[model samples]
Target: MAKGKKKKSQPKGKTITLKMAQNSMELTVDGKRRLNLSFQEIAAVPKCLQKLCEVDELDMSRNLIRKIPDFIDQFVGIRVLDLHSNYLEELPVTIGRLQNLLVLNLCNNRLTSLPNELGLLTKLQTLHLGLNQLDTLPASIGLLKELRHIGLSDNRFTRVPGCISRLNNLQKVNLDRNPMLTEDTASQESVMISESLYVVTESFLCEHCRKKLKNKKLEISNINKVQFIAAIVANMFLGVKW
Candidate 1:
């Protein structure tokens, strides 16, 4: 019998390094300084983030990061921070240091609550907290007077947060799929996906997904191929370009 090829180990629980973060960063056409480290199998934020002092945007989504370090306060100059689709159970109070932040994304995590310090982002215009385990938000969220859009879909809320109605600048708010909000869910999902929610600079989730959607090889030890296939199919059916 012919010998079988050896199976390769899949990357998992990896922590991103300084070089990796540096290599993933680039300036955009609009002159926004950005660093994108999504879907890199990272399990933690790199300490090197402190060195990127001037960065305006930082994307660390779709990884396995379990805790955002206190050093995150170093990103005071940042305007956007994306931390969706990870395993975060809670956010560090230090996250409030990003006073200049305009957008913050925290979807699809395990978070049940948020730090009251989040209200410090006074200049924030958009905040997404959908697809989490949260049943409530810190009352401080009401301090976001400049907030224009907020996403609270697919959560455990029994009723809309009262603070939402107080946001004088709010132009859009999504609460579909909540235990108490589903009566209007199906009809609102399409509108939410089309005009609001899931903010992204590019059409695709990442360059790797863009080029290897159908044939991306992976070791199955730590992955659920069925779920992966379902996600791809659902995105396609929904006409999402990614």
Candidate 2:
């Protein structure tokens, strides 16, 4: 008779509860420094988070959270915080207190505007705010000199803010799908898309804008050619001595 295969035994250590494991809330203390609570349909942060002082990365994305809890301030050691694809309309002012934050992802939310307090995150390098309802960014955004990449695509801005020009370290800026940029502004700003600073927009080379620019260039070229031919004829006539 064939023997049944033996079941794999659980590793010897603190056992994970079924509820905690199901929600991806297991807090392993054996040198695993990241806490992943994403896609758990969590509406509120768990109280157990207050005890996890060693967590370096906190992923709480794809949840039902509508508001950022003040307790987020307790994650003093957190370096990366991802809260993407949520129902958040506004962030807690306490978010600025995460001085160690390097990457903050709040994309695909309902935010209409950002709090000025966001400027306090001096160490932040990447910020994602795409697919939101932002009409304007706070001038204080210029304070984040360390920022490298920013996602502002699908927002409501008609013009790129002057403050964005001050971020010398800025590398990539996504401004696509915003419908308000004029042809002139788009043409002028298209030069910003280069090796160092990359800007993405739908207005730069759309069919209408391209046709307008091409026609303008062709008109100028034709005028120059006509002027040159006229000058040549005049010079020939003047050189002829009867």
Instruction: Name the candidate that leads on TM-score.
Output: 1
lDDT of 1 by residue, 180-207 (tens): 6335676544222222333222233477
After superposition on all C-alphas, the RMSD of every candidate to the true structure, in Å, is 19.5, 14.3
Predictions in order: lDDT: 0.82, 0.78
lDDT, candidate 2, 1-242, per-residue tens: 99999999633323334357445544546654677877776776665667764577888889777888898898887888999998889998889889999999999999998989889899999999988999799888899999988988777766677777777778778776664555678474432221222463435467987788789999999999999888888988899433
Quick one: best lDDT, which candidate? 1
What TM-score against the true fold does each predicted structure earn? Answer: 0.69, 0.66
The residue ranges of model 2 lying beyond 4 angstroms of the native Cα positions read 1-32, 183-242
Clashes of each: 0, 0
Model 1 ranges with Cα > 4 A deviation: 1-12, 181-242
Model 2 — TM-score against the truth? 0.66
